[model samples]
Target: MRKIPVKYGIEILVICLTPFLFMISESISNGKVTGILFSFGYLILVGFVIFGIRYWIENEELVIQNLLFWKTRIRISEVSKIEKTWNALSSPAPSITGRVEIYYNKKSIVISPKNFEEFKNELLRINPNIIIKE
Candidate 1:
């Protein structure tokens, strides 16, 4: 198994969870909610910090797990292209910076791994036919 370190999208996480936070806080202040809202928010936000996120390659598949709630797997052989991107529209990538987009068989996914070169080189090592653009 090859474990690739993740680059956090803290700003993106904040942006995504801010609304829930505000709602929960307001509800608490107004005594409108019990521990249920707090528990739900804790599951979503604290779960990320506690359970953590990960990316790796195993059995010729790339695996991505985020916030303890999801997992995505992609076959390395199906990957066709890789390039750095900063596209802001929405992506699985945690950060807006140093994002790499992988275009596979009729599909694409974005990931931001901390060690960019290592991640790219590892994929290339497995599938040399993959085209990479700087």
Candidate 2:
């Protein structure tokens, strides 16, 4: 079994946090009850800020887990194509760069495993038929 942590993008983080912080600050300054709700919402965001994404391999399955109660499992044998991509779309991937689109079981998902080569090698070791495009 192997576990790989996800990478993070500082720029993307800043882009996401800026407005949230601004709204919280503005609401608090206005002395509104909504400020308290905003504060709670901010805490929720902070709780998920790290994402805690882990791409772990166990037996023949690849499990993707995050801080939230979110988990995705894909069979190694089901993996069809692995292609490198840099997308801003919200996904399990916390990082914008070093993201890869994994096609599996007639479906797809994007993720960012810190060590791409190692992850790819391990995937191939389990299922040599998996196609990878650089």
Candidate 3:
């Protein structure tokens, strides 16, 4: 099984900083103890969610492990197209950069694996007929 790392760049930075910002704002308005607890809880939740998101290829399928519970599997034979995209629109992609859009089942999902080329090539290997749009 090949594990593909997610490219969490500036987007992750923003996400990591948001709770702290909120914590500071809350502390100024409310109280220190409450703000810290809330911020810690938020941080733990975000960390757990991010830690859970993973992508891998196994048994001729692309597996998307999400939020520690949700798993989205796409069969290799069903893949119709693969394309590189810079779209920041929210999707399965964890990052705002180096994303790939996979088309299948009359639908598509975006993902940002660290090795974008390798990920695309692996998918192409699985489905040689898949059209790759630059």
Q: Which has the higher TM-score value, candidate number 1 or candidate number 2?
A: 2
Candidate 2: residue 126 Cα off by (Å): 0.8
Q: Candidate 2, residues 1-134: lDDT per residue as tens digits?
A: 77876888786678777877787778888887787697778767764755656789998899988655778999999999999997667778887889999999898899988888999999999999999998
TM-score head-to-head 2 vs 3, winner: 3
By TM-score, the candidates rank as: 3, 2, 1
Query: Model 1, stretches more than 4 Å misplaced?
Result: 35-52, 66-70
**Model 1 Cα lDDT, one tens digit per residue, 1-134:** 98998887678767657766777777777877665477476657654653366899999999988656688899999999999998775555777788989998898888888888999899999999999987
TM-score of 1: 0.77
| Per-model TM-score versus the true fold | 0.77, 0.85, 0.88
Model 3, range 34-83, lDDT digits (tens) per residue?
77777778878877776677999999999998778888899989999888
Displacement of residue 134 (Cα, Å) in model 1 is 2.5
| Model 2 alpha-carbon drift over 4 Å, by segment | 33-37
Worst 10 residues of 3 by lDDT: 88-97
Backbone Cα, N, C clashes tallied per candidate = 1, 0, 0
